[model samples]
Target: MEIRNAKETIRQGAPSDESSKPDHTTKMIVYMTIASTAAEGLTGICSVVSSFLNDFSME
Candidate 1:
């Protein structure tokens, strides 16, 4: 039927339409910023724990 053919055409076109989406540069930048912030936070936690352990060991 014509309707079935049209439906198949529409279905095949859907993925190409979705693939033509724009880049998410802004979202990527935001994610990178968040990842950097998390890394800094983890570094601070490690430093603090090391310092505490050193002080306790000296006592």
Candidate 2:
């Protein structure tokens, strides 16, 4: 059916649309996202460790 063909066309076009972005910019975005996520996770771990240390110190 025509609707099915149209859906297929849209699916094929999606990757091209995404690929149109500059590769450097995409890499920067991905790297920044990874870096920020890692930093946030580390911060949370440090906070928990600090809290535990503080509790031990209070005893």
Candidate 3:
């Protein structure tokens, strides 16, 4: 009975320690996604501005 309790306690403790660890891969993925989104937004804005200026200059 005591051995079972000890095993249960150890198992619970193990998960808490594992959960506390920062997953670098997940962080990297999130960072990459944010960077890609920002880059796409900037590119889209630049394209719009360039087209607007071209149209204005032609008018």
Candidate 4:
């Protein structure tokens, strides 16, 4: 019957929705971590470059 099939489909899809939530959360966390690390590396490089330039200019 149509009603019985609808219930079966809903049951089948429940686990899939639950599984996707964790996957999205993990992906977001990984992206944020990578972004922060890249920012730190860039900041360090800029600081070094600025200091080097200042030293060179003084000479």
TM-score leader: 3
**Tens-place lDDT digits, model 3, residues 1-59:** 99999899998885676789877998899999999999999999999999999999997
**Once superposed on the true structure, which residue ranges of model 3 sit more than 4 Å away at CA?**
6-12, 15-21
Question: Which residue pairs in candidate 3 have backbone atoms (N, alpha carbon, C) closer than 3 angstroms, thus clashing?
Answer: none
**What's the true lDDT of residue 38 in model 3?**
100
TM-score of each: 0.56, 0.51, 0.65, 0.58
Off by over 4 Å in 1: 1-23
Quote the positional error of residue 19 for candidate 1 in Å. Answer: 15
Total residue pair clashes for candidate 1: 0
Q: How much lDDT does each candidate structure score?
A: 0.93, 0.91, 0.92, 0.90
The 10 consecutive residues of candidate 2 with the worst lDDT sum are 14-23
Best by lDDT: 1
Instruction: Note the residue pairs that clash in candidate 4.
Output: none
**How well is each residue in 1-59 modelled by candidate 4, as lDDT tens digits?**
99999899998885665676645777899999999999999999999999999999999
Measured with C-alpha atoms, the lDDT of residue 8 in candidate 4 is 96
If ranked by TM-score, best first, what sequence of candidates would result?
3, 4, 1, 2
The alpha-carbon deviation from the true structure for residue 56 of candidate 1, after best TM-score superposition, in angstroms, is: 1.1
